[model samples]
Target chain A: MSNKVHRRRFLSQTAAVAAVWTAAAKTPCRALAANDSWGDLTGRLVYDGAAPERERLVVDKDVDCCGKFDIRDESLMVGADGGLMNVYVYLRSKVRAIPPELQKTVEKQVLLDNRDCIFIPHCMKIWNSRQEFYIKNSDPVAQNVAFSPDLDQPANIVIPVDTDATWKFNRPQRKPVPIACNYHPWESAYIFPVDHPYVAITGEDGTFTIRGLPLGELEFQFWHERTDFLETRDWPRGRLTVAIRAGLNDLGTIKLPPVLFAKK
Target chain B: MVFFSAALVVSGCGQSESPGFRINLDGYDPAKVSQAQREAIGEAMEEFFGTPDVPRVPQELGLDAERIAVAAGPVEGRADGAQHGVYRQHCAVCHGISGDGAGALATTVDPYPRDFRLGVFKYTTTRAGAKPLRSDLRRILLRGIPSTGMPSYAQLTDRELAALVEYVVYLSIRGETERYLVQRVIDEGEYLPLGADVKEEVFDEAAVWAAESWAAPEQNPEDTVVVPPPRPEYTPPQRAASIERGKQLYASKNSQCVQCHGPKGDGDGENDLLYDDWNKPKIGVTPEETARLARLYRLPAQKLRARNFREGAFRGGGNPEDLYLRVYAGIKGTPMPAAGPQAGAGGVLTPEEIWDVVNYVLSLSGRY
Candidate 1:
């Protein structure tokens, strides 16, 4: 009887695997070329008004260790030129073909470190589900990382001082998942894990670049920690539909109003 | 109590319509899942796993249909004197027909009966965020949770016990799958009357993932199982010294045991306001919002208390090894973080240090 059950299970599992492959094959694919159709997306997010003063985080615990670090509010960071920091932009639609160079990033490990009781690289992008997400604690004080993803399995493990830990997501998440430290409530970070390689996070200059995307119309999602979804008048639910052309496709200086970042 | 129990059984059996598992909308925005969407979810669940009276065990889940058959259905004796409806006969009064834990007597208990829909078992041999082993469930059945209304089924035959264990797993998988389908429907915005595409893409994957989590402990014991190192025998003076060391580590920033467990282990931790993963969602942005959400979710949100070692009636087990595992893996869904090394990952405390802390905790409980 058990044998019969096993055989039936094996058959069903095999069918499921076949179905996944067929589904994968159905995704939109464009003609592959080294330099022909491949293009880069460049965009900048600027604050419409004067940059709000960054709030100073209260170092309640481990004052001797955490208080020394110049830790300001990381939820929103606008530079001198009004360039916003830590805005995530990623492809929503499925695309099969990818440039060879960008494909290599799937194997690379993305690092998120803890220094002076603060999560370094407050915002990060995990290019592909296959890539390992590594976390390190450079501080002398012990820190625990609570990684809770919406779709994937959640993990809340401790990262001892000077030691490191690694996590891997089983599937892509619809939105960036918050990585928080329960011990130190203020220590927080966000990780955007997607299956596709077309993902980027804005730097201090408020600019982001996705090296090689298929030259065609694709829907992309924009997200920020403060604002749940980077919704705009033009982009509903932060869904930006753009046509990727050959060479650099620069979306010239998109201005975001200060009202968007106002506390709800 | 006897009359109440009898009344419950009569009420349960007297129903004209068959009892079905409720579609868990707990912690979900009531507006998000429309009436039509709810109907779709109900239909999909029914299609995959039949009514509680007659279960359709998915082959991929590796559940024994014979075992499930022995456990499910209305209680009765056959001509041969063999028993059926083992679960309904013994457990349904408390565990409920669907194992939702909202039984007739659920509210009467201090700590409400555990809603297994979340798939978070508090006591388990497996590590944090992992499913309990079959053995772990069997152990609970035999010994039972000490302070809770859950009574030991020690008098039952091994076969009957085995059947109950398998049934629990089945119910858990079914419940978890229901949650997965709800998420898929909301996230993907699938139209009503979910099609073959959903069955293939969403339901199958959720079932397989859940089944695998249950199987992982047995399949890969090295990674999932927590094995405590041998406790070093201590003389009178040496034991005192070890306890002193543990006391320091407990207060140290490395463990931060004082923050939640309190400096005196009196359960009056500074951070008194704590909720487990299960109850956290029920809490809204404000008190008024929480009160409003209480209407949506039937059960009221309850705060989780960090264990007071001084009054030690450990839920998992009171043995030194159990304490060692607690400090090692931490309790799942609660604030207790894993201090000892996890599988393939570094941790704050070493095995020896964890044992020391365990010793300190034991001493606080006046066990030493």
Candidate 2:
């Protein structure tokens, strides 16, 4: 009995593999270029201002004041509007020179699904070297869109219920951008501009590390959407001093002082 | 007479038989015969010829005197008291004297003490987390929970450990049987006869079968309630603009949604690693419980537990609107601060901005 069952399974697996191979053979030829020469770039995108003031409400249906709300009176709200937080800075070393392997990995369309009335991933690092980003609304509710610019051109489009939309950037701008849904004002996130793959995002602990750099003094630009207050104070903006040695080198802690916000 | 005796012996030898064929009837006295000689004669007579009387016991043959001098070696004994005493001293404090887990320290814990009385042990491969396998129990006992107060007891001897395991199982079975009976009484109200005619039992079985018959259909709260149809798809240029806008809003500190919700929307915010409101180290509930609650709320487990967020229940929420309402209207009697400026509260973001924030928050859980 056991031998019979095993034989059946083996036959089924072989059939499935054959079907897959047949399907692959029928697929149209789309050549993918692989570029091994492209290197990674890593840096921090800082927001130099205290986070914006917003009402933080707790929702408890059983409470006596279930609908009652309050504003937080804290000194700071971390990673607020246009904060340039969790930006993925990468290198686009060979922009037009597409290698076969690299071209295959470049997706023609990237989908961002909106379900449960929120962005599935609060933040996304898109390598929009090829296809434009497609925003999809899977819910049956109204939604509004807001974008802050680090792109060469500013784009803002409102998305309605159960609709799909796309946003395209014609040129690269070396600045971190912000995006939000105005219908649900509390929903917000950040995007960083990069032409390379060498960038890494600062984790929840606000620490980022990038490794395997060629030995040299490389000039890197760091831009954040919340750069107004920091620039005014003459704090370091858009540039870091580093002498990359052949071996591992530790770039010590980078600190940005608290940005004060005036009461509205 | 000598010549006759020699002739008898020679004849007996020739026949391969003993030469004790004396028939002296005149001078034969029974008392004169030794005990050994009488026994041998009796045995030979029984073997060679059929005899009626035969001795079974030594006393029956007047040889009971020889049995008094043999001494029996010391009998083997076991030290069961010492093994039991060790368990009572070391284990009774937490395991209880009867291993029912109603020890003095059972109370005042977030998760109640492991009630061995029910034999429903957690952290086991057994069915329904009940009754840890013997080896499973030993592993827990040897390696106690690091953060909790349970300490490891790896010092017990192999023999002692074996004895303790048996005793624990005995106590658990006894207590669990009692608990099961009591629970049955409470649940069933009264004991019914086998195959009793009960309407409730029939109705319950029918309901179960009906529920299992097909996949559940989506619920529509009200047939009369008219929902607006979905909007038309945006043009390529319009969508491109929306993505740009979404990206811009994400980078700005004006929203600050990424602080608590997490940049990746994985819900592992910096605050998540810190101590919770109850001063307990924050390790979220088990994945199984989370999954069960998600099913109840009709949402995916990856989404935040914001849907079922009732004021009384500080941790969970029920729906997208429910979380939206919580964000708009703060929870009462809890630390979950509000995010809307209405109700004379700090309404920093306009109604439109709140909607945007709602969209962003929903997006975190794939609700957007």
Candidate 3:
């Protein structure tokens, strides 16, 4: 059979070329607008009630390797000061102006290590469709990362001891995907993959900062593993639309009520 | 009066007209997707890709409309001595009229027949995350998947095979497009009577993107196809050494093939609760939700078993090269991870190491 560029390919390629040309034509104007409007989003997710005691997960298998460390359910973590940890906050839209620093961040590899039979950083945000996700197995026991993304392909890979592997998603996910190890069922983590860099995960102190966002009206989503969506006052679907300013936009201590975490 | 009208209509026709494509209800959220919205989606799908009796393809998709005609409609010998309705005559029984994989005998099989709606094929010569080449799909039709109900249609002529292959592609694209439309409706909370704007927006990206992926192999065969290096010829001792190396790799923590495929090469592995991409969705986050989701799906979620080297019936071909590809690409949509080198990145196992693993697998099945 003769090699021929299919019609769809031809159309898409021409469209891409046109897009590049147009982008080049307007680069100066866009650069001015971007630099003038770029800002940051800083916030802390705080649990309204007292800190809930985390239940220690039972580690029955590989006691010498896995049970050496005290493993606890990282879901719904609250610090002494009522700061909630591992809350995901991200821009709702797929398309946005990506700053140079954010573009560079996509180039660097993000690590998800299996240390002491626990997935390090229980929650993470992969900020681009083609971002390199590095997976390392630091423990001695065998671990398999069941990376299942709804829109993209799912991989259940066996990452052996002291070895690391890199994975990249072809498509940005609609929602955060849960990665788990079947061997150690308790070993689980969540990853949010988006095409834009406007995402942040809360730290142990419940703090997160997403810098260099294009100033304008933008919608953001807050999600947690325990509570499906961090539904605050009047923010349905945990989505909050805000008009960003030229400087730091501080959304101080957004309190989460205990009722949101109640299980039926 | 309604019953009388139905009876009259049934009596008037010699045979009942087959039902149109049923939208995959599981794809939608009942709370969000209204009955009217579903009807709208169904109508749009029918408009883009016609009914089973008379199919149609959008010109922009660049699909082979001629082959679709040969495969659709009632099974009959045309005046030009060509065959029609080849799909219904051969495939619809298991794959269903819409290629949803819920035909008459679908539930009877242990592992359900593939639902082409997802467009995720497990076995292919293509690399990970890439659509299979035309030759890959042909290979499946020629050599039927072992240990499954899907049978080989080798008896069919080249023309018949081509028609069937194109028809399958057509059904996959149509099914995927329908899913895309449904997702958009649910995501956007669009009301009934979907306007022309929605159709155009969906067709411009969803359908066009799907068509591009299906055409990728033909357009960029070099990038899509996974070509294994030439197999090393070994003397008796050399072959033994390769198998030994493979056995170690299989058992070692580096590859950990023994974790799922047992130390004895038996299917019984440590982790028994393994599920594929198809069944994984049916499993909800909570046990209660899992029960609810399970009831909604066609079949109960089935656990996937690691292939037993002792059994030796590889679902993908039993050739050395096939085994090489399996280890290299990993079984798509399954738990088997790609052990071979990927594009611009190294995998868990090197080419030589994968070769060793293949030799060990062959030895387990007494192929060596």
**DockQ score for candidate 1:** 0.24
Model 3 Cα lDDT, one tens digit per residue, B201-222: 6666567767888888789978
- Each model's TM-score, in the order given? 0.85, 0.28, 0.84
Superior candidate under DockQ, 2 versus 3:
3
lDDT by residue for model 1 over B83-152, one digit each (tens)? 7779988888777877888788877765667777777777777787678888888888998776777778
**DockQ for all models, in order?**
0.24, 0.01, 0.17
Which model scores highest in lDDT?
A: 1
Minimal lDDT window, size 10, model 1 chain A: A18-27
Q: Candidate 2 residues B225-275, lDDT tens each?
A: 112223225476754454445445533343333334445545443323222
- The list of candidate 2 runs beyond 4 A from truth reads A1-123, A148-154, A209-215, A228-235, A244-252, A259-264, B1-368
Candidate 1 CAPRI level: acceptable
Q: How should the candidates be ordered by TM-score, best one leading? A: 1, 3, 2
Better of 1 and 2 by DockQ: 1
Q: After best superposition, candidate 1 residue A252: deviation in angstroms?
A: 4.0
